[model samples]
Target: MKIAASLRAGVMATAVVALATFQPTPVAAQQASPQQTVRVGIHGADIGSLDPHMSAQTIDNVIHAWIYGGLVRFPAGTIDPTRIEPDIAESWTKSPDGLVWTFVLRPGVKFHGGYGEVTADDVVHSLKRAGDPKTSTFASDFASFDKVEAVDPRTVRITLKTPVPSLLGLVTAQRGGYVVSRKADQEAAGQYTAKAIGTGPFQLEEYRSKQFVALVANPDYFRGRPKVDRVVYRFIPANESRDLAFRAGELDLFYGRKEQRWVDRMKATPGLAIEVFGPGELRLINLNTSMKPFDDIRVRRAVAHAINRADFVKFVGADVVSPNPSVVPLGYLGYTDQVERFAYDPEKSKQLLKEAGHPNGITIKVLGSNRSFVEPYQLLQAQLAKAGITMELQLVEHTAWHAQIRQNLSAMVVYTAARFPVADIFLTQFFHSASAPGKPTAVTNFSHCDVADREIDAARIEQDPKRQLELWHAAQQKIVANVCAVPLFDEDQVWGRSTKLEFGHKLEASISFGPMLTEQTVLK
Candidate 1:
C-alpha cells in the first residue's frame, strides 16, 4: 500500500535478482511431489483487492477467476464472444424487445466455505452490487441496467434501460460479471473484501499477506472434482526473482517476461513450455489534456510524433507483441485504423512545439512502476529527447502506480490493460468525459479528453450496427486528431509452465488476461 522510499537500480526488471527471497535452499521439485499441487508465481507485492467486482488489476483478477463464477462465461482457457456457455445459469431467455432477461440457476450450486446454496437472491444481489459505483470499479460497464430481481427461488430477471450490444457479455465471467454469495458477503461484513467466497472449483484456505495464498480444491464443485489437489499462489514482485524461482523448480508456473530475449532463453530450458496469449493488452501513453502544455493540441501532437511505435514493437519482439494502430484495441467490434495518427517525426515534433510557443522542448513528469514499466519508459524518455522533449519519471513500486494514477497525480501515464473485447467498454472508460479523473464517476480517463463525448454516447445506444460503426469511427478520428493519447503496442501476455502440466483446453485467449486455470487443469 505504500511506495518504498528507495529506488531500484536502472535495469530491465527481469535482470534484477534476489535469490534468497524466492528460491528454495534445497527441496524436491513441486511437480514431482505427491501433493498434486501447482505453485504459481504472481507479479505483485500483494493483492490489491479480492472483492471480485473491485479486482481491476491483473494479478487480483487471476485470483478472482479461480474463486468466482458468472451467470454466463467465456469458455475455459479462451475468450470468444460466440462460444459463451453457462456457469451459474443453467438456462436463460430474453424478452422480444431485448430489454429484459431471465435466468434459471443451476440446482445445488453452493458457495465456498459453507456459505450454503447459491440462489436467485444471490445472483440479484451480486449483479446489483456490480452496478453500484461505490462497491465496484467497473460500475460504468453496467450503466444500461435498470433493475434485477429474484423471480423465484431459482429464477432471476434483469431489466435494462435499453438494449445493449451484447447482453451476455455483461453477465459473462469477467470484470463486473463475476457473482458472489449474498449471504457470505452480508455475514462477513467488511471482511469480504480481503477474503473471497465463491462457488468456483477453488476455495481460499489461508492468506498470509505479502507472502502467498493457499487454495484447496472444492470437493463439491459443480463441474466435477478439480484434477489438482491444491494451488499455492505466491507473490514474487520482482521478475528476476520470480524467474529464478521457476528455473530452480520452486514454482510450477510463473508469469513470463514478454521480451524476445527472455522468451528465447526460456524456450531453451528443457521441460519449460512458454505460452504467449491474449487479450493483447494495449499499452498507451496518455497525455493529460486538462494540464498545462498538454491542453494545447499542437503540444499533444508534438509529444506523440516524437516517439516511434516500431521501436517498441522491435524491442518487445515481433512474436510476443502485436502492433496496435488505433486508440481502440485491435479485434474489438468497432475497431478501425482509418483515423489520423501522428507518425514518428522528430523535426515535425520540434516545429509543432515552436508553434505552441515552446521553442525549447517542454518537460513532463510521469509516475511509473518499476516492476511493470521501467524499461519501456526509459526507451520512451530517450525517444522523446530527440524531439526536444524531456520526460522525467518518478519511479514507484507496482501497486503504488495503480493507486497514485487514480488520484490524478501524474501529468502523463503509461498504462497497460486488456479489457472486455468491446469498443464501447474501452471507449466509455478511457475516453468518455464521465470517467475523467477527479470526477464523480472516475474510472481511468487519465487524458481528461472531451473532444468526442457526443459521438461516444450516441454510438453506444445507436442500435443500428452500420450507423453505430460510423459513430464509433468518427469518435476515434476526433480523439486521434486531438491527440489525447498515443497508441503504442498490443502486448500479448507471456507465461511459462512445465510441459508436464496439462491445462485441459487449448490456450488461445483469456478474458482474465492470464492463463485460465480450470477444474480440469492437471499435473501429468
Candidate 2:
C-alpha cells in the first residue's frame, strides 16, 4: 500500500497515442469474446479497510457499497440522492412530530455466508453500532437518536431526541446506514473484514493485498442477480501501469487523471471513453481562527482576498471542475452565492493587512499532504505572494497531515471532498462548535468557526424545506462574513472505461460512494 513515486510519462503518452490510432476488433471477433467478468484497474496501492462504518476513503467506500445493503437506499443504477427507495426495509412510516420512525423489514433477504435471514434485530444492532462513537465515523450524524428498538421480528422502531426533517435522507446513506448481520459480526469477532457478510448484489470472494479485490455475483440477492458474474478491482499504483493495462485491453475501466490534457488523450483513444460527472469535491481553504494572525477577522479576510480561485482551478483541470461559491454545492437544496464576497482583489488584501498592523504582510506555515493538497497549496503560495504574503508549505504524509490538522497546527488547510448528501450534514460536521477541533464530536471543523452554530441547529429542526434552506443559506453568509474558509472549486470526477462495458444509468456524481456499479452494470 504505497503511492507510486514516479510514472513513466513517455511510455504512457505513447500508449495513449497508440490506443487512439488503433482500430477496434471486428464485430464477429468481439461477439465471440467471453464477457462475464468486469475488470477495473483503479489508481490505488491498497484499500484502508472494508468495514463500512470505519473506512472513509474513496476506494474503500466503492468496495463497501457493492457488498453492503442499507435499510433504505438511493435510486438504483443512479447516485442522485434526491429520492429514497426501499432496500432491506420494504416500507417505513414516520410520526407527525418526526420523533419516531418505524420500518417494516422485507422478508426472505438472507445475509451472505449462510448467516441467516436479515430481520428487525439486525437493523437495530447495525444502527446502534453506527450511533456509537467508538465504532462509527458517522457517530455525529446519529447523535440525535435517543433509542432504537425492535418492535417485532420484522418491525424496527427508531425514536429521536428531537424532530429531524432529514432523518429519512440520513438513513438512506451508505456509510453508516448499512445493516450487517449481528450474529455474523459476533462470530467473526475482529475478522469481519475477511468474512464480510451482507445482502448485496455482490459478495466478497478475495481481497489480496496490493493486488486486487474480487467479488462474485450473489445468486440469492433479494433484488435480482447481477448481469456480470464477477467484478474485479485491480490495484495499479503507477499511473503508467494503469494506462498501459487499459490500452492493452487487460482492464475494463480506471480512474482518469484530473488533467485536461490526459482527458483529451483518452477521449481520442479508440474503444475508450471518458465519464465526467459531479456534485464533485468541494475544494476549500480552511484558516485556523485560533492561530496567530488569523485570530483577527481582518487577517482572515485579507487571506481570502489574496487567493485567486480561478488560478487554482486551472491547475486542477477546468474540464472536470467548477468554482463553488459556498461550502454547499449547487446541486444541493441550500446552496447560495455567499462566497462571492471574497472576489480576487490583491489591493484589498494588502490594505486589510496594513490595517491589521501587519503592513509588511505575514508568513504562514501550512501543513499539507504531498498528494493533491500540496500542488494546490503550492499554487496558492504564488497567488498570495502578490499581496506580499508568504506561504511556507510543510509537506507531510497524508495520514500525518490529517492528524496534525485536527490538532489545530496548520495556519491554513486545503481539502477537497464530495461530502454528505444533505446541507445539514455538511454544515453540522464542518461549522458547528460541537465539531470543533478538540470537541467531543470533532471531525473536519479545523477552522473552529462556531459563529454559524445557531443557524445550523435551527435548520436541523426547521421541518419546512423552504425555511430550512433559508436557515442554511444564512449560515453560509455568516461563514463568509467571518472569512472562515475560502472555497476554491467543486471538482468533477473523471473515469476511463472500455467500450465493452455499459453502466445501465448515466455515470452519476455520487457523494455517498464512487460511480454506481450495481446489479444492472454489465459487460457488452
Candidate 3:
C-alpha cells in the first residue's frame, strides 16, 4: 500500500487557482506561464543554513550546485562514458606519475561581490580549508591531497600523497572541492556558514529556515545567466502535501515522493513525464555488527535469508525500482551480477537460527524512520514470523534515527547512501574498518565488519584500473557473503512539473536542478 503525508501546514493556493472560474485572469495565466518563477518542493528544510560544509545531505548538495561551481560537474545521465564537463576549472592535466594534477581555471570568472578575478589562489585556499580538520568542510574525501599550490594565475596544482583514481570524480562533488573567493573567506574569518560567495549561475538572495531558499540568476555566471530569473526551493516534508502542491501549481518540481498510487496517477496525467535511470541506489537494512545478535555472522545471514526481496519489490512499485543485490548498483563499471543474494527460505533461516544456538525463538528489533522505510520493516516483521523470529518494529523521527544509529543502539536499521561516481568512494567510505567506530565518515560502516579494513585499504591505492575493480569486487563479495546488510529496492525519485520544465535521469543518484532551470524552458 502506497502512503504519503504533507510536510507543510496550509493548502497550497496554486492548486486552488486551477479550479477557480475563468474570469479574464491574464495575471493568473501569465504567472502560470513558463516565464514566471519556478517553485520546487523538497522533502526537507533548507538545513538551518546554506553552508556546504555543514552537512552532506542531498538537499545541501543541491544548494551547493547553485551557490558554488566546482572544478568539474558531472553531466546528467550515465557514468560509464564518465563525462567530465568544465565548470570553474575549464581543463586539467595529470602528471605521468599520477601524483600531480594541474587544473586550468576558467578565465574572466568573478566572485559574487565583483571581487577580483578568480585565480589559482582561490583554488589553493579552498582545498586547504576543506583539508583542514578544524574547518570541518565536507570535502574530506580529497583530504589526501598533500598540498595545493598555485602554479600560475590560471593554473593550480594538487599534489596527492598517493595515486587516487577517483580524484576527478571527487572534485566534481558538491562538497568535494569548490573554489571559494579568498576575500570572502578572510572576511568571514573562517565562519562562512549561512553565507555563500562563488561563481555559480545562481546567487543566494535570501534563506528563511524551514520555509524557503531564494536564489537569483548570476549575471556574470561563467556558464552564462541561468534561464530562470529566480529559483525558490520550498520545504514540503510531507509527500501528500508536496504532491498536492505540485498538482495545485505551487511547485514546478517535486522529488523523492514515491507512493505507487501517486506515481500511477502522475503516469496517466497528460502533462506529466516520468524518467527512470540506472545505477540503482540501494536501500538496505544495516545490521550493527558491534552489537549482539548481529555480531554473529550466522544470525545476520539467517536474517538475510528470511527476507524475501522479490516480494518487497512487488509491495513497492517495481516500475521504477529493482532489488539491489550488491553494494554497488548494476550498470556501474566492474559491477558483476555474481553476488548471490539469499532467497527467501523459512527452513534455511530456521536452520541457521538453530545452528547459531537460538533454539528458542529469536527476537530482533527492526528500526525505521519515517514512511519511506516503514514498509520494509513491516514486511520483515511478517516474514521473520515464519522462521520463529520475533521482529519488533520501531518507527522514529529522522533526527532521532540518526542519533540512535550513531550510538549503534539498534540491532537492524533501514538506511541508504547516495551513489558515488567510483566504487572506491563506496568501499573507503562505508566498509573501511578505520572508519568503523568514531570517525564522521559518510561510509558509516555501522555493520562494524573488521575484515573490511584490509580490503578497503587495498582498493584505495590500487592504481591499475583493472586491479582496483578486482579489489572492490572482492570486498563487496565479502560484505554480501557475510550478510552485513540485506539489500533491498532502489527508491524511485519522482517529480511533477509543468510541461515547461525539462530534465532527465542522472546516472549518479545525485539530483542536478540546473538543467531544468535553463532559459530554454518556456510556458505554453
Best candidate (score: lDDT) = 1
Which of the predicted structures, 2 or 3, would earn the higher lDDT when compared with the native?
2
Each model's lDDT comes to 0.81, 0.77, 0.66
Name the candidate, 1 or 3, with the larger TM-score value: 1
- List, in order, the clash count of every candidate structure: 0, 0, 9
TM-score of each: 0.92, 0.91, 0.88
Model 3: colliding residue pairs: 6-238, 6-241, 7-238, 14-248, 15-248, 34-523, 227-519, 429-443, 430-443
lDDT string, candidate 1, 78-114, tens digits: 6767788999999999887778999999998898888
What's the true lDDT of residue 444 in model 2?
80
For residue 468, give model 2's deviation from the true position in Å.
Answer: 1.4
Candidate 3: residue 484 lDDT (0-100)? 71
Worst 10 residues of 1 by lDDT: 1-10
Model 1: CA > 4 A from native: 1-33, 193-195
lDDT of 2 by residue, 1-524 (tens): 01111122212211111111112543343234354777777776887777777777777887888889988887753445567789999999999888999999999999987888998999998999888878788887898999999999999999999887568766774888888989987887867787778888889888888878888889889878888877778788677888877787667778777766677666666667677766577878888888889999999989888888877777777787787778776566677885546888999999999999999989999888865655566678888999878998899977677789888889988887766557787778777788788787886858588899999999888888889889999999898788788888777777777766777766565544356677888876
Winner by lDDT between candidate 3 and candidate 1: 1
Q: How many pairs of residues collide in model 2?
A: 0
TM-score-based ranking: 1, 2, 3
Give the poorly placed runs of model 3, Cα more than 4 Å off. 1-35, 76-81, 137-140, 189-193, 440-445, 503-524
